[model samples]
Target: MDTILNLGLNDQTVQVLAEATGNERFALDCYRRFIQMYGDIVLNVEFNKFEDALERNKRRFRVEYDHELQPEHLKKIIDEYKEIIKSSTGSEFPQEPMEQLRKAVMAVFESWNNPRAQVYRRVNKIPDDLGTGVNIQTMVFGNTGDNSGTGVAFTRDPATGENVIFGEYLINAQGEDVVAGIRTPLPISKLQEEMPEAYDQFQKTCTLLEKHYRDLQDIEFTIEQGKLYLLQTRSGKRTAAAAVKIAVDMVKESLISKEEAILRVDPDQLNQVLHKRLDTKVKFNVLAKGLPASPGAASGYVVFDANEAERCGQNGDKVILVRMETTPDDIHGLVMAQGVLTSRGGMTSHAAVVARGMGKPCVCGCEALNIDYKAKKMTVGDSEIKQGDLITMDGGTGQVILGKVPVISPEMSEELQLLLQWSDEIRRLGVFTNADAPADAKRAREFGA
Candidate 1:
């Protein structure tokens, strides 16, 4: 995995391939990109300078992230990018195809510690030390005009664990260009209407890749004048909902066994989605602001202290649980409150994790608020608010609105459940979903993951 590889043909080989491809521009563009990436890693080019130069070239061409490009526009963009590198660096973009291959190999290995790459590793729990092995086979361009395109597809739905191939694509675009979600992307389903032949090919390819990988594969591929080129493939992640549905369906398909199904799900994720949520559509009265330790919209009379919160709940008054932070003793109040709030704690802090597991709405770490339990009021920055007030918090986007805006319940359709069943059958692993609240857990259970 730590090995660097030099790839591609020499001048004579490039010339031979150019004749075969009948596109000098395409060959050269690939040659240059390989050099740019590789040179930065192996030759130690200053990245900031490289980016600045790249930006100037992009400005020079007036190219946008927009994908609606004709054949001419794409050729110009690539040609100009090469022109920029030459002009900015005072050298030709390396044309010795072997040089390009060499640089690409170095670049991929170097990507392991790239800033964003580091962050991705931390979040995904990938080890920081495992270097990547660069893979360089043949260059495949999707922007070769009418018959060309690129797309990303997952063998199973990542959101609801549906068994169908789920993904998106853009015609006349490179493989990575469409997945960035820069501009609005066309649905993968669009291919059926736009190019039925291509659509059929993609569908069949997805099935083959899934079976070959023996996992929920996320694939990157392109069609160069109607022929498919698979650029890369890896396992895909999914929402808790999708996890359950897919696990069950995959069982039906005999892809996984009963015990395997249970293990497929992340127990923690299931816990998070089960929190009680305030009906998003319900209206709320404006009152105090504080931390939401868990997530769920809540509308109730303010209870300044845990004892009061518990007492009010006993009296059958829906209560807004207010706290600077909750201690173990406050558990009863937290359970009774329509929602819990904390003035402290990070996402991994007690309140944050508990709230997620409970599937409760919480806005935590709101440092601006100071609770005055004795006075029955809280100070939020310059404002002071009293007990008996109402407010709402959204756990999903971390938005706390003055009043309720609109709410919609998410119910899994039968098709979704069936799809996940297929995913379970194929993976031969249990696909339990994350959920903490009744609604969220119900949603997951409905999917049968």
Candidate 2:
């Protein structure tokens, strides 16, 4: 999706903004961000060019983060970014508010059929004809200063279905900074320390939203100048285990009935609930360890890049995608891969979140593995593994194994069993077994056939 923040800011409006806000540094920061995002998303300028400039200015100023750069440093970045856009697109940056708005809207509409969107719809079986809609709202600055911030929160834990506010936030940042994984974000719990009033309000708002929606809600919000504003909210995506647990828990809490709970769990997702795990008796060569981002085990030939992963998967090869870290642009490859291993990024990074949502095994922040994307190789200690090498990874344990190993299917959790029972009680149709043997028939019956 294309999100152009701080739009309609030009040399003229920038001055007016600085005067109105009484903060030149904040105004310039917003202007620079606008140029970088607008130039990359709308004007087709290379995003790295802008990033490189920002990095250079940060180093020149001896600062660590983007928020630390002063107004003068940001001015330099804005000028360089504008030059990059002009050179890359053969035109100057759009100054007219209407022109900027028109291009941004067009870009968003064009994203409806983008490769990632198409792949997502295909993988999820969403109708292609449903299309997409755009929502335009007034801009609110989360990068205003220390008193402002942005965050993404789920009413319940999307991983375990626990009833708690689970989220991450970045003070003095825009919404993108939280999800982009450019900067490690603080846990949502830290919000109470930084801005108590906003945190309290957000907590109450989340409780009310969950009550009103009667489901786990993914909420986006910004606190500008110590005042909170909700940007968006939707049904939160979750892992298969979480889905089953949440449905059962909601029923027990009297928030939903047994029939509704049964219907809420996707029948196809039960396979993920009965996810496979590495055989405990098997002796395996452990290559490295990292954070267990999702729960499952997968063994496949490794692929170094997203494009290769997608191509290999389409050709009927089970592949594990290895990367330094994944981004939103990698959804197609992520969808195709059986599992993912990353050298960087935490549990809530793009790779981890997407993998969990798709019920794919994932290991993140495996810093011991030195990845060389150009050579399609990864090295750990003295061992080197090339592309297409067979490997197994246990996302439940965060262990990357050297070769394919035996796996054992896990029993369904209690919540899943209860959910199945509820479904069986409410289902009107009768099920018949196609099994040819007594044992097969018995197993089918055990599965409520």
Best candidate, lDDT: 2
Write one digit per residue (lDDT tens) for candidate 1, span 243-326: 666666676778787566667767666543333444645665433443333444555676778778878888898876766655
Cα lDDT, all candidates: 0.59, 0.87
Q: Which stretches of candidate 2 lie over 4 Å from their true place?
A: 55-64, 280-289, 343-346, 365-371, 378-386, 432-445
Tell me, by TM-score, which candidate is best: 2
lDDT tens string, model 2, 274-387? 778999998887999987878899999999889999899999999999988887678889988999999876666788788988999999878899988779899999999999
What TM-score would each prediction reach against the true structure? 0.55, 0.90
lDDT of 1: 0.59
